[model samples]
Target chain A: MGSSETFENELTQLLPRLRRFAFSLSRNGADADDLAQATIERALRSRGQWEPGSRLDSWLYRIMRNLWIDTARARGRKEKHEAPEEEAQFVGEDPRESMDASLELKRAMAAMNRLPDEQREIVALILVEGFGYREVSEMLDLPIGTVSSRLVRGRTALLEMLGGSADG
Target chain B: MVEEEKFFAWLDGELSPDEAARVEAAVAADPELSKMAAEHRSMAAGLRGAFGAVEAQPVPERLQAMLKGDGKVASLTDARSRRQARLAQPFWVQAAALAATLAIGVFAGSQLGGGQGSPIHPRDGKLVAAAGLEQALSTQLASAPANTGPRIGLTYRDTSGAICRTFEDRAASGLACREGGDWRIRSLFQGAEGQAADYRMASGGDPQLMEAVDASIDGEPFDAAQEKAAMERGWR
Candidate 1:
C-alpha cells in the first residue's frame, strides 16, 4: 500500500479511542460524533503536517481539543442571542441518557462533566486515557506542574461529586 | 495540599523512585492515607469504566468509509471546488443557488403550534423520534403524505444499510435513520421558529444537514419504487 494508504489504515484503527476521547470532551453523543468527524477531516487534509514517527493519537487529540475550543466559542456567541428560556429547556437534558453504562458509571461521568473544562481535560487524559503527566502537559501546552495541580483539583472535585457513593 | 499532591503523584506513578517509596511507606503506615488513596483509585476506575463504553460501539460506518478514500474525502474535495466555482458565478446565479437549496417554505399558522410538544425525545442520550415524527417516518411516504405533522423529505439507505429519512416540522428539520426498531435522529437543525424549510431542495440544502447526509448516504437516495419497497419491508 502507499504511504497515504498506511496512514488511513492507522487512522481507522484509532477511531474507537478517538471517539472515546471526543465523548469525554463533548459530554454528549451528537457533539462527540461531530467533533470526531471534524478531527478526521482535518487530519486527512493536513496529513503532511503529522510527523510519521510521532504518536498519531496525540496529534489527533490536540487537533480535537483545538477544534472543540473553537466550537465552544462559536456556540457561546450563538447562545448569547437566544432567549434564556429557550436555553433552559435543554438544560435538563441529560447526556448520560444515551449511554448504556451502569448507574455508578453514569454518576461518575456526570461528575466528570461538572468539572471545569481545564481540569476535566487533564483528569480525562490522566485517569481515563492513561496519558503520562508530561505527555498531557505537552499535548495541552502547559507546564507539567500546572497539569499535576489541575489533576489534583479535578480529582478532588470528582471525589466530592461522587459523594461517598464509592466509599464502601 | 502539597503533601496531598505528592500522594496523588505517587498514585499516578509520576514521582521519582525515591519519592514513590517514601509515599508508599507513608500510605502503608497510615490508615487515613490508605483510604484516601483507595478512594482515588476507585474513582479513576469508575471513570474509565464509564468513558470506555464508547470504544465498544461499532464505529459509525461513515467514519470507516472516510478512511477508505472514495467516500467523504472525495466529496469534500468536490465541495471545495464547487464552492470556488460558486464564488465566481454571477450575482443572480449565486442568489438562485441559495434560494434553491434553502427553499424552506413559509409554515402555516396552524403548523406553528406544532412546537408545543417536541417530535423527538431524548432517551438515554439518543434522540428517538416520537409521536407525529415517528409515525411520519414509519408510514408516510415522500411520494404521498397527509397534510399534517412534519413533511417527510428524501428516503434513502445510509452507507450502513439503515433506512434514513429527512423531515421538516414547524420547529426543526433533521435526518433520522431507522435503527433497532426506532427512528434515531442523526442530525437535527433547530431553525429560529419557521425560518428554515425543506432540506430536500434539489440544490444546496443546509450545509450541516447535507454534511450528515453526505457521510451516511451509500448510493443515490431511494427512488420512488425503491422507497416504496423499503417501506413495504418495514424499512428493515
Candidate 2:
C-alpha cells in the first residue's frame, strides 16, 4: 500500500486512544468525539509536517492539545456543569458506586480545571496519556524542567482537591 | 540516600532501580510516605478506569464515516437519510460535497446571512438563515416543502456542535451561526433552487428578520420543556 494508506491505517488505530484522551479532557462523550474528530481531521491536513520517524502518538496528541486550547479560546471558557451533566446523560446509569465515583471524578476534574492551563495540560499528558516527561516536553514544546515543575504543581493541586495531602 | 524530590519520579517508574529501591525503603519506613504512595496509586488507577469508559464506547458511526473519506454526506444524514440516499452516489462525491462545503464556508461566508440588502444582518456570530433557512430548519421535515425553495438535509447540532445540514441544492448548503438576534453567513457553498449558483448571492442579512424568526437563544437550547414553553409562548 501507498504511504497514504499506511498513514490512514495508523491514524485509524489511534482513534480509540484519541477518544479516551478526549473524554478525559472534556469529560463529555459528544464533546470528546467532537474534539477527537477535529484532531484527526487536523492531523490529516498536517500530514506533510509530520516528521516520519517521530512518535506519531505524541505528535497527534500535540495536535489535539493545541486544537483543544484553540476551541477553549474560541468559546472563551469551559464549564463545570456541561461536562459532568453530559457524561451522566450519555451513560444513563443509576449504580450507587458509579454515582459516587462520578461525583468524586467531577470534584477532581473541577480541581484540575482550576489549575493554570499549562500545568493542567502537562498533568493530562503525563498521567492520563501516559507520556513520559521527555515526551511531554517535546509535545508541549517546553523544557524538561518546566514539564517536571508543572507536573509537580498539578499533582499537588489534585491531591489537595481530593482532600488528601498536598505535600507529596 | 534517596532525595525527597525523587518520590514522584520514582512512583511514576521513571527512576533507575537503585533510586526506586531507596524510595521503596523510605516508604516502608515512613507511614505517611506509604499512605501518600497508596493514594497516588489509587488516583492513577481511578483515572485510568475513568478514561477507559470512553474507550469502551462504540465509536459513533458518523465518526467512522468521516475517517473513511466519503462520510461527509453520510455525516449530514442520520440512518434514515442514509438509507434513502445510499444507492445514489459514490463515497468520493460525498467527500467532494463535504470538502466543497468547507472550502466555500471559508471564502464565501456571509452568504447564508449578513450581507448588504440581505434580509438578515449577522447580529453576532449566528446566521438568522433569513426567514427561509430558519423555517426550513425548524419545520420542514423530509424535504423542502414542495412550494418552497431547496432544503438542506436533516438538520441538527451534530455531535460536533455545529448546526449542519445537507442542501438538496448543493449550492445552498452554506451555514450561518446565530449570534444573539442576527445570523452571519460563516460560509456558503451552492445555490438554492433556480437562483444563481453564483456563490456570492446572499439573502438580505437583516437583523429584524432574525427577531421575527425568534431563532437565536442566549442560553442553553430548549429542552423538551422549553420547547413546549416556546410553543405556548407562541415562539415570540
Candidate 3:
C-alpha cells in the first residue's frame, strides 16, 4: 500500500485505543469526542510532522494530550476561577454493567476524576491503558523517574480519597 | 533497602528480579513494609477497574466515521434512504420490511429520537431494553406470526459470550443480549438496512446490523433449523 494509504489505515486502526485515551484525558464524553475528532483532524492535517520510524501511538498521544491541554485552558478561561474541574470521564454510560457490578469499581472510577492532571495522565497511560512505565515515559517525553513517581503519587491520593488504607 | 517507590515499581513488574527480590524480602521481614505493599497492590487493582469503564464504552460513531473517511456512506442518515430504492425486493414489499438497521450506538444518541416516545429506558442510570421491546426480543422469532411486533432474525453469541439477537419493529431496530434475565440492548438505530443477503435481512437485517452480528456472533446465525432449535432451547 501507498504511504498515505498505510497512514490512513494505521490511523483508523488506532481509533479505539485513541478514543479510550481521549476518554481518560478529557473530563467527559462530549469533550472527549470533540478532542478525539480534533486530534484526528490535526494529526491528518500535520501528517508530515509525524516521523514514520517513530511510534504512531506515542505521536498521536502527544497530539491528544496537547489538544486536551489547550481545551482545558480554554475551558478554564470560560469558567474564570470556578471550582477545580472534575476529570477523566468514561465516554459512554454504564460500561461493563453486566459483568461486574461492585462498589469498588464505582469508587475506583470516581477516584479517577480526582487525580491532578499530570498524575492522571500517568495513571491512565500506565494503570488504565496498560502502557509500561518506559513507554509512558517516552509517550509523555518525561523521565522514567517522573513516570513512576507520578503513578505512586496518584495511587496514594486515590487511596486517601477513597478512604482506603495503604496498609489494607 | 526497598523504598516506597521501589515497592510500587516492584508490584507493577517494572523491577528487575534482583530489585523485586529485595522488596519481597523487606516486606516479609517487616509489618510496616508489608502494609505498604498491600496498599500499593490494592491501589493497582482499583485502577484496573477504572480502565474497564473506558474499554466497555461502545466505539462512538463519530470515531468510527473518522476511521472510514473518503466519504464512505455512514450507516445512518443518507445511506438508508438511497439504498431502499435499489434494495427493494418482493419479500420486503409484501411483509413491509422496515429499512431499520440498528446503528450500533445510535439509539443512545440524540440523532434518532426522530420524534415521539424513545424506545430505550434508563434503569439505575443504565440504558436498557424495555417493555414491548424486551418481550419481543425474548419471545418473538423471525418467522413468527406477521404483525407480531419486533421480529428476531438471528440468534448468536456476542464476542463477550452473551447471547444477542437482532430485532426491528417499524423504523427502529437493535441488537439485545440476555443479561441478568433481561435483554441488555447493545446497539439500536433506525434508518438504512445493511448489506446482508436476503435471508438474514428480515428480522433486522442491514449492513450495520450485520457488522454488529459479525463482531459479536460466535458462529453463523441460525438458519431455519437453527432458529427453530434456538427458539426451542429458549435463548439460554
Which candidate wins on DockQ?
1
Instruction: Return the TM-score for each candidate structure.
Output: 0.60, 0.56, 0.52
What interface RMSD do all candidates show, one decimal each? 9.8, 11.2, 13.6
Clashes of each: 6, 27, 5
Off by over 4 Å in 2: A77-111, A163-168, B1-4, B71-74, B78-236
* lDDT tens readout by residue for model 3, A1-168: 488878888898888788777766665444455567668767876899999978898899888887776655555653455334433333234332323434454456567667777898888788767889998887788999999999989978877776545332
Instruction: Name the regions of candidate 3 deviating beyond 4 angstroms.
Output: A81-109, A163-168, B72-236
lDDT of each: 0.69, 0.54, 0.63
Better of 1 and 2 by DockQ: 1
Candidate 1: segments with Cα more than 4 A from true spot: A83-105, A164-168, B71-236
TM-score of chain A of 1: 0.84
Report how closely model 3 matches the true complex, as a DockQ value: 0.19
Give a tens-digit lDDT track for model 3, residues B63-161.
Answer: 556455433212232223213322222223222223343243544676325334455666566566766677777667665634756666567776677
Error of 2 at B191 (Å): 16
Task: Write the residue-wise lDDT of candidate 1 on B1-236 in tens digits.
Answer: 23978899999998999989988998989998888888889878878877787788778664675677542112333233234334332233343335433543332223334564656666677768888888999998876756878877677788888989887765566889998889998877644221122111212344455566767888766766777899999999
- The docking category that best describes candidate 2 is incorrect
**What does candidate 3 score on TM?**
0.52
Task: Order the candidate numbers by DockQ, best to worst.
Answer: 1, 3, 2
| Residues A73-156 of candidate 1: C-alpha lDDT, one tens digit per residue | 545554455422122112124442334544544465567667777898898889989999999999999999999999999999
